[model samples]
Target: MITFAVLFIAAFCAGVQNALAGGGSFLTFPALMLTGLDARAANITSTVALFPGQITTGFAGRKNISDLPQLSFKALFIISLIGGVLGAILLLITPVSVFEFLVPWLVLFATLVFLWGSFFRKIHENPKPLGPLKAIMAQFAISIYGGYFGGGIGILMLAALTIAGLDVRTAGATKNVLGGVMNASAVLIFLFSSDVAWTQVMVASIASIAGGQVGAYALKRVNEKRLRICIIILGFGLAIGLFLKAHGS
Candidate 1:
């Protein structure tokens, strides 16, 4: 009962954070680890658990999504699909010790990228546009990362899309949709893995879906900037905590 309650609350906030600015894994992943799963298993379970909420968010934002100026939506979608499959395969073969060692650093890198993008957005109201080739490359790389770990993937996508000359709304909607696509592929691959905790996945999935709806509705009333900052703080905190855990063990 206690574990379920904790997971429910964490997943709920994760859904809200994912809807608002994309660091929900800071909550869900760690929450899974604390539930006694090892790092690799936790990561896989988190991906499966949050998938339904991601689908919901993507469907809800479909109307506002658009292709980048240089790349068609179909091309971008294909890149994400292929990248996701490759990443998931790589993850499945990775050793548990190796994954545990890498988790903190990956989270730290993602946090820094999220922080840098936030700063970049604030400093340059009209940043120079990214070239099509550069944007496509970035998307492919980030999609692979999304499939492998998927902590702050939305931040990565939003940054790439914004650099590609998209406005905030369009970039956000595009991120949500492409995120769902990447995860959909990854989930299919992860389904065959033995590491997933189906019970936690089911609990988090249902809770996150409900929370996503609430977060979508709360978008009208919430201060997005504040919510983003809170998630960033949570990301940093989780990264630090995981670093200690990894080193201590």
Candidate 2:
């Protein structure tokens, strides 16, 4: 009962976070790892479970989306699709233990990226306009990282979106949509070879969806600076926790 409650509470909180600032994995991933699943299995299962959360975000934002920045959206979506697929493929091919060492650093980097997102944008950029070819390649590359282990893909995506010239809402929407695509592709990629906690994922997903609706409504009422600070605080905490878990364990 405690385990079930933990999963539900985590999912609900993560759903709200994902809806507001993005990074549902911050909660769900650790929760899964703490379960009996091995690191690889936990990662794969977590990616697979992102679908429902993405769906919730998409639906909540549906009405506000009048036009999808067609050219850019297609460019980004295609790129993300290819990247996500590749990430999944890489996971299927790579050995699990080989990745265990990388998680801590990746999480740390993602944490820093989120904590200093605005600064990262102010100081530097992706160098070019990121045409179709570049867009596809970039997303594909990020997807590989995301599929292999998505600790802070949201932070990475947001940074990328700035370069893509997408506004905050559009970028968030695009990220959610592309993220869903990545998770879906990863699901196919790991279906046969990996262990998936379907029962736990289903329950968590439900709670996340319910909480997401509430989040969509809440995003409008909240102040952006306060929210960003709160998210950064959580991101920092998650980063430290991951560091300890990776090193201490």
Candidate 3:
């Protein structure tokens, strides 16, 4: 009961965070770990559990999705799918001990990325545009990282897409779609893995969906900047805690 409660609350908050800004994994991953899952299992379970919400969010923004002149959305989609599969395969073959050691560092790196995207990226008024080939390469790399860990993939995608010449609005919607595509591939692979905790996935999924709905409704009313700041603080705190735990272990 307590485990379900924890997962429900964590996933609920994660969904809201994801709907508003992205970084749901930051919440879900740690919550899964607290439920006694190893780092690798926690990551797999979190990825699997959060997938439905991602798809829904992406679908909701579908009308706003657009293709770039240099790279069609279809091409990007294919690259994301391929990269995601490769990354998932890599994760499955990685030894548990090594993944455990890597988790803290991954979380820290993701937190830093989130921090930069949220705060610093805005400081630069104009971002240099990426050529089609460079954009494709960047998206492929981001998709692989998305499948492997997926802490700040949304922000990463948004940056890349905007630099690829899409406006902020179009880039945001396109990234959401691409994020779902990549994660869909990863989730398909995770479904066959023994690492997934289906019960936790069920609990978290339902809660997250509900939270996403609430977040969608609250989007116009809430102060998004403040919300982003709070999430960043929470991310840093979680990263620090994970580092301490890893050291103790």
Candidate 4:
């Protein structure tokens, strides 16, 4: 009961974070690890558990979604699906020890990426949009990463989309949709994996869905800058804790 309660709270917060800025895995992944799963198993379970909430959040912001001039949304969607499948395959084949060793570094890298995207990246007054080839390439790489680990894919996509000429609002909405699309492919693969913690997945998924609704509703009303700062701090703190844990072990 305590485990379920903890997972529910963590997943709920993750859902809200994901809807607002896109680093929910930072929460769910660690929470699962604390529940006694190994790093790879935790990651797989986190991806599967959070997927439904992602869809809900994306759908709630569908109105702001738009296609890039360089690439159609359909084209990007297909790329995400293919790349996600490939990444998932790679993850499944990765040894547990290797993944555990990589987890801390991955979290750190993702935190830095999110920090840069959230605060440091400057939008030019007359930004040049990425060409079709460049946009496609970027999206494919991000999709693969999203499938494999998905720490900061949301901000990564937002940066890519904004560079491709969408406004912040549009990029955010599109990012939400594409994030779900890529993860949908991963979830399909993870559903069959022996690593998934279905009991935790069930509890987390329900809590996350409820939290997504709250987050979607708060998207406009909440102070995003403040929320993003909180996420950044949490991310960095988690990264440090994970590194220490890894070193001690």
Candidate 5:
């Protein structure tokens, strides 16, 4: 009962974080790991568990989505799918020990990226348009990372879209949609794998979906800045915890 409750609460906050910013995995991944799953399995399970929320948020924001002039949504989706597939394959083959060791660093890196996102967005507020090739390659790279870890991919995508000439509003909506696409691609691969905890996935999925709705409605009342700061702190704390776990074992 306690485990389920914790998973539900973690996923609820994760959904809130994803909806408000983009660090849901910082909560969900560690929460799963705490349930005695190995790092790789936890990561994959978290990906699967949180996927429905991504789809829900994406569809909710679909009408606001705009196409990038340099890269159409269809092209971007294709590139992201291919990248996500490759990344999932790579993750599947990675040794459990190696993945465990990498988790802390990955969380730390993603946290830093999340912290720098607003500054980067400010810098790219009026960026010169990216070339088509550059934009495609960038999106593909981001998609690969998204499939691999997926903590802060939304912010990364938003920054890329902004630099590629999309306005902030359109870029945010595009990020939401593309995030869902890449995650869906990865989730399909994970579904065939044996690493998932289906019960946990189901619980977290329902909780996250409900939480996403709550997050959307709470936007007016919640202080985003404080929420972001809390997420950042949690990310660092989780990274430290994982690092110790990796070293102690």
Candidate 6:
């Protein structure tokens, strides 16, 4: 009963944070890991459970989402799909010890990229000739990282989208959609091969959707910049902690 209550609160926070800034895993994953769960299991569980929050956020923002300039969902899906498949395969084949060592560096890099991401948005406001391709490449590359470690992926995706000439809100939306793809793929793979706590997923998913609907709707009335900044700080601070923990363990 306590775990259910805790997960419900966490999912609500995650849904709101994800809708505004795209880094809800900063809350969910660590919370799961703290429960004596193994990292792989926790990663899969967090992604699967929080996925509905993202979907709800996406759907709630349909007015804004549908109005965004021509994005090739087909093309985006292809890159995300291929990347997710390869990432899952790589996860199965790779050694945990090796990935364990690399996790700190990955988190640290994502933090720095997000910190200095203003340059990418301001200077590269418009994509050069092959901008869309670059965006796809960025998403493809990050999908592997998301699959492998599942931390700070929102920061990575937002940074990549900035580099590809997207404003923050658009980048946030695109990041959410891509995340849904990577997570859905990863979840399917995990379901087929591993034991998943479906009860947990159900609990978290319902909580997340309710929270996400509220959060996405609030975007219409709230101060977005302040909210986004709060999310970024939470994300970066958590990333730093994850980095330290990665090396500590």
Model 6 weakest lDDT span, ten residues long: 62-71
Measured on C-alpha atoms, candidate 3 has an lDDT of: 0.76
lDDT of 6 at 72: 67
lDDT of 4 by residue, 169-226 (tens): 6676788888899999999998889999998899899989888878777775656577
lDDT, candidate 3, 93-127, per-residue tens: 87545444665665566557656665787665665
Query: Candidate 2's C-alpha lDDT?
Result: 0.67
Off by over 4 Å in 5: 96-126, 216-249
Estimate the overall C-alpha local distance difference test score of candidate 1. 0.78
Candidate 2 local Cα displacement, residue 127, angstroms: 10
Ranking by lDDT: 4, 1, 3, 5, 6, 2
The number of clashing residue pairs in model 5 is 0
By TM-score, the better pick of 2 and 6 is: 6
Residue 171, candidate 2: C-alpha displacement in angstroms: 2.1
Report model 1's TM-score to 2 decimal places: 0.84
Ranking by TM-score: 1, 4, 6, 2, 3, 5
How close to the true structure is residue 205 of candidate 1, measured as C-alpha lDDT? 97
TM-score of 4: 0.83
Clashing pairs in 4: none
Clashes of each: 0, 2, 0, 0, 0, 0
Off by over 4 Å in 4: 96-125, 222-249
Off by over 4 Å in 1: 96-126, 220-249
Error of 2 at 8 (Å): 1.1
Q: Rate the local accuracy (lDDT) of all candidates.
A: 0.78, 0.67, 0.76, 0.80, 0.74, 0.68
lDDT of 2 by residue, 1-249 (tens): 677688788888877777665667768877776666777777777777666877777676765432233345666566667777887888877785555567556656655655555444565554454355555665676777777776667656654554455645555556666776677777777776648888777877887887777777776566666765665675666667666766765
lDDT winner between 1 and 4, please give it: 4
Q: Give a tens-digit lDDT track for model 5, residues 1-249.
A: 787789899999887766655567768887887787877888899989988987887676677677788568899989888888877777887655655566677667756755665344586466468789998988998888788877656556755776677755556557767877888889989999999999889989998887766654443345556654654675676667668867984
